[model samples]
Target: MHRYANPSRFIRIADTIFPWAGGIMITAFAIGLYLALLKSPADYQQSEMVRIMYIHVPAAWMALFTYAFMALSSAAVLIWKHPIALLSAKAAAPIGASFTVICLATGSLWGKPMWGTWWVWDARLTSVLILLFLYLGYIALINAFDETERGGKAASLLALVGAVNLPIIKYSVDWWNTLHQPASVFRLDGPAIHPDMLWPLIIMAIAFKMFLLTTLVTRIKSELIAARVQNVQRSLHGNLADGRG
Candidate 1:
């Protein structure tokens, strides 16, 4: 793990894996969309409106999963000081933030027809909303300092602190009486969703996961390149100062 922390090594690995991940993401999304939008039957209750689930559910799941990834990476950086872990967390923040916004926006779109409202202050929705703020907050904090290291460390701390919200978002339905639906796929009694709907949802979820991985690698590559450029400039300046001295 530490050996791969070297930027060159990390870039080499990312270069190898990113193309494959991107290809798989594109393929999976194509198949998943076909299964979700074309092949799957409309819900007996919600009809065509349920089609929103294909996009909304996966975005919502990725919202939580991406934060978990960031929090864990932040923890690794704080505890073990792994530069790659920190860079990975930094790379993931914006992507996670975008997904969180999509989840909320799509949820509202789905909700208006079914619930007769565009938004509600339900427990599940509120927790997920807070999750969005957390992402933005992390991003803001990361850019708040003149020293990039200071900003990164401060943002990492915030990410770890905000992680407590993940479980709250997950169990909001169980813990509070809310408009949001309870767990259908992850219940102790087993999944409540039918196979026709379930398979497409699973496929979409996997596609979303791959999509995040694809973007994360790209972002990390950019970060590594930028860092290398900064280091080269700093070294040149230091040598010039020594020569003048």
Candidate 2:
């Protein structure tokens, strides 16, 4: 893991993995969508509206999963000073934020038909909302300083501190009487969901995870290229300065 901290090495590894991840992501999404839309039985209660779960639940999972990854990357950057860790965390923020937004939006769409409201101030909803804010805060902190290193350090610290919310988001449904349902996929004994619905949900979750990996790798590669260009310009400027001096 640390060996790949070097930008050159990281890029080499990412290049190797990117195409495979993209291909798997596309294939998984196609199969998952087919299963979700065509095969899964409609809920007896919510009927066709329950189909939203295929998107909403996965986005919600990714929202929390992305933040957890960011926090871990931030810790790596701060503690080990891994060169690419901060960049990886930075690259993941917008992607996570987008997932959070999708979760919220789709939830609202699902809610309108099921709950008779588009929005609610439930504990689970609020906690996930906070997760979205944390993502935006990280992005802002990372770009706040003129010195890129300073900005990265500050943002990394913020991410580490904000990690407290991840657990809260996870247990919110368990802790309170909320509009959100309890865990159906993961339980102490086994999954509560019927296998027919469960299979599509699992497939969709895999597709979303793969999609995130593909996007994160692309974003990090772009950042690495931009950083390399900046370094080259700085070197040229320094050489010109020394020549004149």
Candidate 3:
């Protein structure tokens, strides 16, 4: 596993996995959307408005998952000094931020119909909004320094620290009387959702994971290429200076 930390080796592996993951993502998305939008029954309570769950729930799940990935990569950077750790962690920020925005936007959309308001400072929603801010902060901090290593280290540390918020986001509803629904599908006893609706939601969840993987690998590839270009240009400039001296 550690051997794959070599950037060249990692890129080689990413190249091979990229296409298969992308194809799977597309297929899963098509099927999931069919089930979510067409086959699934409307909620007895929320009626057609429940369809928003397909998008909103998945976005929220992926947002949490991506941040967890970043936190783990940050741990690898700080503890093992893993070569690809910072890059992988850095690459995840924008993607995570995008999903967080989706979660917030969709939640607001859902709220207007269900809760009669477009916005609220409820525990779960507020925490998730904070998650968005955290992602933005991480992106900004990563690009704040002149040196890549310095910026990477600072961003890595921030990721680790921000992980504390994840649990807060997850349990905020349970711990408080928030308008946000508690865990229905992930309960310890069993899923509260019916099999008919549950299947599409599960498939959509898988689709979101596949999509995140596809984007993450592509972003990391770009980061690696940019690093190589910077190194080559520095070497060329140093050689030309030596010749002039």
Candidate 4:
């Protein structure tokens, strides 16, 4: 991992992976959407409305997964002082937040017909909302300071501290009486969902993962290039000031 601390090396690796990630993401989305929308049978109870789960569940899972990834990156930044760690965490924040927003919106759309309400203060919903706020807060904090390093350090601390919410979000239905259903897709016994539904969900989840990887790499590369340019400008200005003096 320390070998990747060099931005140039990291970008080289990312460049190699980017096209593969994009291709896989596109293919998986095509197949997953076909299975989800056209092939899978509608729910006996919810009917066509269950289709929303195809998008909502995957987004929710990615939201959690992205945050976990970001938190680990932030930890690397703090503990190992890995040069690319902060960039990875920073790049991941908005993506995670966007997933969180999609999850909330699609969940609300699903809930309206089933729960007779678009919004609820359920344990699961509330915890997920908090997760969104944490993402936003982290993004804001990281840009709040003029010194990027200082801001990143502060935001990394917040990311680490906010990790406590992950478990709460996962087990909210189990820990409390919430309108949200308990785990059906992931169980100690096995997934309770039928294979027909499960396969599409899993494939969609893969597509989401690929999307994250592709976007994260792109964002990290941009950050590295911008930082290099800024450094060059600073050095040029400093040399000019020295000549004048």
lDDT of 1: 0.91
lDDT of each: 0.91, 0.92, 0.91, 0.94
True lDDT of residue 125, candidate 3:
94
Count of clashing residue pairs in every prediction: 0, 0, 0, 0
lDDT of 1 by residue, 156-227 (tens): 999999999999999999999999889898889999988989988998998899899889999999988988
lDDT of 4 by residue, 1-245 (tens): 87778888888999999999999999999999999999999998899898899999999999999999999999998998787899899999999999999999999999989999999999999999999999999999999987679898899999999999999999998999999999898789999898989999999999999999999999999999988999999999999999999
The better candidate by TM-score, 2 or 3, is 3
Off by over 4 Å in 1: 242-245
Please give the distance, in angstroms, between residue 216's alpha carbon in candidate 4 and its true position after superposition: 0.4
Q: In model 4, which runs have C-alpha deviations exceeding 4 angstroms?
A: none
Q: What are the clashing pairs of model 4?
A: none
Model 2: runs farther than 4 Å from truth? none
lDDT of 3: 0.91
lDDT of 1 at 221: 95
| Candidate 1 collision pairs | none
